[model samples]
Target: MKNKIVAALLAFFLGIFGVHKFYLGENLGGILYLLFSWTFIPGFLAFFDFLGLLLMSDQAFNAKFNPGIPYSVLDGSRSAQDITVALSQLKKLYDQDAITAEEYEEKRRKLLNEL
Candidate 1:
């Protein structure tokens, strides 16, 4: 949620620097966005990013779990380890292409239940 907010702001303001991509832990994606920003690509990409984030679920955000202050703020009422593990697994699966974006979200909600 926080990343999404930051991304929205960056997309609207400092998107050329790809601040939102960095915020999302997408360092490579951010760099790519930055490199092409001058070509007007980043701005266009930011629009899609904004839309994707808007369509993203709270559960999906929770599953990404980058940690820091936002982690506790979003769902501190739940166990941290449960969220951590879910985030880890999701990340692994994402890297492995074992699950689609839709599946990642559903599994995320299930993992949150463990918390």
Candidate 2:
């Protein structure tokens, strides 16, 4: 669970020494930044990285750093198969009288709109 604010701060403050790169688990990049810290190029690049981190959406950050979550959930998009399965489950609940007809219709529309 890498935090966007933390990464941005690290990049801005300690990025010349590749602290942000290390936080992001890019050892090679961190090492390279350390190697060239004397030139100050890494500092300038780290500034850009800081800006980029600040501009990036939280979901994009999560997708990049957090593993194991489905891409559909992260992006808020769903495939036809997902919608189909969800609709079927909803239909089963409706048949079982677990949900009212009005509820079923509303939920069904919401699921379909994800296409």
Best by TM-score: 2
| Per-residue error (Å), model 1, residue 46 | 0.6
What ranges in model 2 sit over 4 Å off? 69-115
Steric overlap count per candidate: 0, 0
Weakest ten-residue segment in model 2 by summed lDDT: 66-75
lDDT of 1 by residue, 1-115 (tens): 4556666677667667788888777899889988888898888778777777777776676567354445444655547765796589798997899889898888887777766
lDDT of 2 by residue, 1-115 (tens): 5778999999999999999999988889999999999999999999999999999988788878766666676557888987898899999999999999999999999998888
* All-Cα superposition RMSD per candidate: 12.5, 7.8
